[model samples]
Target: MADELDWQLCRSFLAVLDEGSLSGAARALGLTQPTIGRHIEALEQALATPLFVRSPQGLVPTEAALEIRPHAEAMRAAAASLRRAISGAEGGARGTVRLTASEVVGAEVLPPMLARLRERHPGISLELVLSNRTQDLLKRESDIAIRMIRPTQSALLSRKVGVTTLGLHAHRDYLARHGTPRSLDELDGHVLIGFDKESPSIQTLRAMGFQMGREAFALRTDSDLAQLALIRAGAGIGVCQVGVARREETLVHVLPEDFVYSLDLWVVMHENLQTSERMRLVYDHLATELKAYALTSRR
Candidate 1:
């Protein structure tokens, strides 16, 4: 069984685990669904155990799949490290760097900064993966990640650049139409915009005395970019990052002193890629630019 196992089979297995379905895994791997299915079938045959079970939602990994995941992940990480090492050896800060960030930051904050980076390092090509879900750095899903929360993975290098504050805000027109809430209690009377699903930010707000449920939001969406767009469109009052809100002149901060939360910004990369000049350059550039951006919100 050990002799039959190979990186290709392991790669497909991990992709399915990460994506939760054959189609998703195929898309992630840039392979056909039938090919991905064959890989999974071959992997299961070699191991002589079922890797997944059919469920209404999607493929659910069996205990056997979960048990072997760590070892497979370690192999994937090792391969990535080897690639990074070789690329670094042949580099002059000229290589590809994959970066991941939340949708809002990627769309709103990063464009100008990334443009500047491109101007400075013409040799460095970048791949940006914008997502609300944190990319797995250890899995090499992304070479560098700009995350709002601190990472707990020991195998990654990280830096706490700064904190970006968030506060309730609404378009000027919305406030004019429906008076601004002066206090927390008044929020219930007004149409609120927020995440449809519970998240770390929502949980933190709950812990900080903003005891509200998903039902509280009149317009609920998990996408921060979409939430900001809704607020800008005068849909409702919603949470907006200070740095982001500052750019929109029509966005009025609501109960600024009352409703405020800060998210710590982090730039992270795999520990194995520390020597990769391209990765380091991109990481440092983000750290510097993001810190400057955070300062703008405070003022």
Candidate 2:
């Protein structure tokens, strides 16, 4: 066993953990399956512990693997940040920048803005990770994160973009077919699209005086995009950001005064990236563009 841990080994280990199979990790890392297997073996030998065990489904991670995963992820993030920083110093904004955001924002909000960024800085390559769960900026999971809520990590440099204003909305056809619910109490009689499980958004809505549950929804899904799709298909009434809803003429506001869910949007990155021009450039660009987009939600 040695004190030094190889980064490549850690990468393979992480890939296997994420993909749940050597073949999947091999494809993800652009390496041969045997290469990935060797890396995992070397890593396990270095630590003198079995990281994973064979299972009927696939390679199931051992307790040791789960414990070491975060440390490996942190190292990966640091190495990526170092490469970006060095590239920024030697040249200009020419490197990969990984950005994470909620699914709806990633699908609906970021594409055009990222396109504009690519136009402005052709050397900058972008990687977007879309997930509703918060990505840990401190761990360097992403170079920058566009978050719906204010980030509380002390090591993160965050900027409040603006409020993403949400309101109850439905397709015109659905409203025409079912008629509009005149009040909150009347919602019981109407079809609704909402989360099938409790999430931060659902809890927030509950706190805001919406007394609906999973059973209340005619169609249920955790994905914001899926919910919006259902709304567009005239499936039922659901909540959507005004900024997003405005793009579809078919989506009409159901209760202008009744349901308003505003979440503070933020763009955050690790403080270590302060010196990286590419990171800074993307951060500023996101702040400016996202603020403008959020302002539209106010309308």
Candidate 3:
């Protein structure tokens, strides 16, 4: 153990925690397996505790390791943010910007905009993290985020992009085969695609008379992308972003009058990064592009 904790040891610790083995961590960090093993052993000695217990499945994290993970992850995010900040100051718009958004938005919405951005400023690079789970800007988990909800955190700078309208949609082929439901109640007779587990948004919908129980869905998944894919695949009638559905000519809007839900979309970044020129460029670009994307469903 040394006077000050080494960050490399912590980085290796976090990698092993995520990947579940020394070899896996080594591959992720581009280090050799023996180096990763030594880092882990040093980290454990520094902390004065055993971090992992081996099993037939692989190295399983002990309770101490699990408790240390969030702090280690926070350190990783801070290190990345610090690097980006320094690079931004030195190179103008030539630095990496990490952005987070939901799966559907990351896949379907942002690629074209990002391609254009790259064409305009080839020096600027992007790292996109796609998940339904919200990344904490305060912790610097992501430099910027596209959020469905309002940013209530004190140190966040946010721009309301627009609203994303959600509605029932079905492939033309599926509708031709099964017939379109005239009302919300008629949905019971058709194959429905929806969330396997109730989320806060679904709970809100249910409170507002939307029927989205797990049992009601014939094709069940929590991934918004999966639900949208099922609708595109003619799997069944499912809830999808109206803007996205319009992109596919085969997808037909179903029960527009009966069901209309809007999720408020925002582009948010940490207040600390508001002064960074490169950060501002990406932040405003996202707000502009997403606002346009949100308007497509108005048709």
Regions more than 4 Å wrong, model 3 = 1-3, 204-209
TM-score of each: 0.81, 0.90, 0.95
Model 2, C-alpha of 119: deviation from truth (Å): 1.6
Report the Cα RMSD per candidate: 3.4, 2.2, 1.7
Each model's lDDT: 0.87, 0.89, 0.89
Clashes of each: 0, 0, 0
Comparing 1 and 2 by TM-score, which wins? 2
Error of 3 at 2 (Å): 9.2
lDDT of candidate 3?
0.89
Error of 1 at 164 (Å): 1.0
- Give the Å error, residue 217, model 3: 0.6
Per residue, candidate 3 scores C-alpha lDDT tens digits across 1-299 of 45567889999999898898999999999999999999989888889999999999889999999998888888898899888777676756788899999988899989999998888888888999998888999988899999888889989999998989889999999999999999988998999999988876677567667756799899999999989889889999998888888988899999999889888899999998887778888998889999999899663
List the candidate numbers ranked by TM-score, top first: 3, 2, 1
Task: Give lDDT: candidate 2, residue 148.
Answer: 76
lDDT score for candidate 1 against the true structure: 0.87
Higher-lDDT candidate of 1 and 2? 2
Ranked by TM-score, the better of candidates 2 and 3 is 3
